[model samples]
Target: MSKPVVLTIAGSDSGGGAGIQADLKTFNSTGSFGTSVITCLTAQNPDGVTGILEVDAGFLEKQMRAVFSYFPVKAVKTGMLFSESLIRTVSRILKEYRAKGQDFHLVVDPVMVATSGAKLLQDEAISSLIQELLPMAGIVTPNLDEAKILGSGEIQTSQEMKPEAISLSKKLGVPVLLKGGHLKHSAEALDILSFPNGESLSYSKPFVQDFNPHGTGCTYSSAIASYLGQGESISSAVGKARDFLHSAIVQSFPAGKSKTLNHNPD
Candidate 1:
């Protein structure tokens, strides 16, 4: 049997700890063939993002088209689309691909903020993402801060997360994987997966006491998409992905002077 092919459309992390690098590592670790289309390149380390250079929208579209034309992409995951034009281009590609009857799984990790407190997406791009890409997503993953931004400051607590997830799913007409990583709790990391079919799943893991777990959200969502490409159901894929991320965080290593890189399994 052939391994599944997974593609990540995101930013490049110069530190090799997050964004496109992390997504590819997670995908390969999960036994999938990983590919990438970089939206932006960041000169960043664990401490902070020093600079970012975004690729032109035309070039981004060309890259996406080239990948789709050549590879049998089983699943596609998106992260750190930094501009409104990039978001729209991605949405257009997805819409066109769907029109061709391609059932490519899409995992959207709405990466609006970085672990070092840097804003990864433009403020105007947030509206574009919600309006354009959300409806086409198979699963939209947003951490607490991203959720609050998406919800317009409505979600604060874990209890509030469920309703917001449901609302977002309904409004966008897609499933949502609302991550609980930013919540100031020690017990468990709870992530809510709400589907349009009126079904919901809550995945929770014992919180690892790692303060420098960078790229966790990217890893989890990309892993889920990889598992989905490997023929797992959504719930099963999410469960396995969560397990993988927990283990990775449990065995994390300090990468830079400040943050750590969660280990992808050997």
Candidate 2:
């Protein structure tokens, strides 16, 4: 049987633990063929990012067109679009593809901040992402901090997550998957998936201790895209992705003073 093709449009992690690397690994692990359009290149490791070189907007459009022109891309995920121009470029291309009657699930991983506390998305680009890119997504995955920025105000606990997710989903006209991994006080890592219809799904896993989840957000969103590409409903995709990510976290291994998710965990 042929595997569904899923595309990841994101930066390249020189460390190989996040961004395009993690996304591609998760896509294959979840039974999909992975393709990529690198938006930028990051010089970094599991420790921290030193520099970033963004791809030009025109070249980004070229890459998108090249991929969609041939492959039957079933799903596409975006991460770390560092600038306003790139965000608008991506949104326009996606809208054009949809206008041409092409069908594909778009998963938006609103990666604003890196695990190492490096700013991945520019502050000036936040508005462009919220306005131009987010509405085109089938689901937008945001961590606690990103959620707080996109939504109304501060999110202190998991209790505050649900309503904010619901509100964000309604506001964006897309499903919102609010990741609570940042809520360290909780015994369980809780994630909420809120639909515009006022429905919500919760996924909880025993939180791993002393572990740095370097590529988790990228992996989770890509896994969802892979599942969605395989024809699963959005809710089912989130559930499956959660389970996959939880397993990867539990089966993590040591790498350069930190741990990396075992993307191909057996």
Candidate 1 regions off by >4 Å?
Answer: none
Error of 2 at 66 (Å): 0.9
State residue 132's C-alpha deviation in candidate 2, in Å. Answer: 0.8
Q: Write the per-residue lDDT of candidate 2 for residues 127-196, one digit (tens) a residue.
A: 9999999988999999989987887457888798888889888888889999999986888899999999
TM-score of 1: 0.94
Off by over 4 Å in 2: none
Write down the lDDT that model 2 would get.
Answer: 0.92
**Candidate 1 per-residue C-alpha lDDT over 169-265 given as tens digits, one digit per residue, 9 for 90 to 100:** 7766888888887778547788889887667889888877845767788889899999999989888999999999988887777555644656565
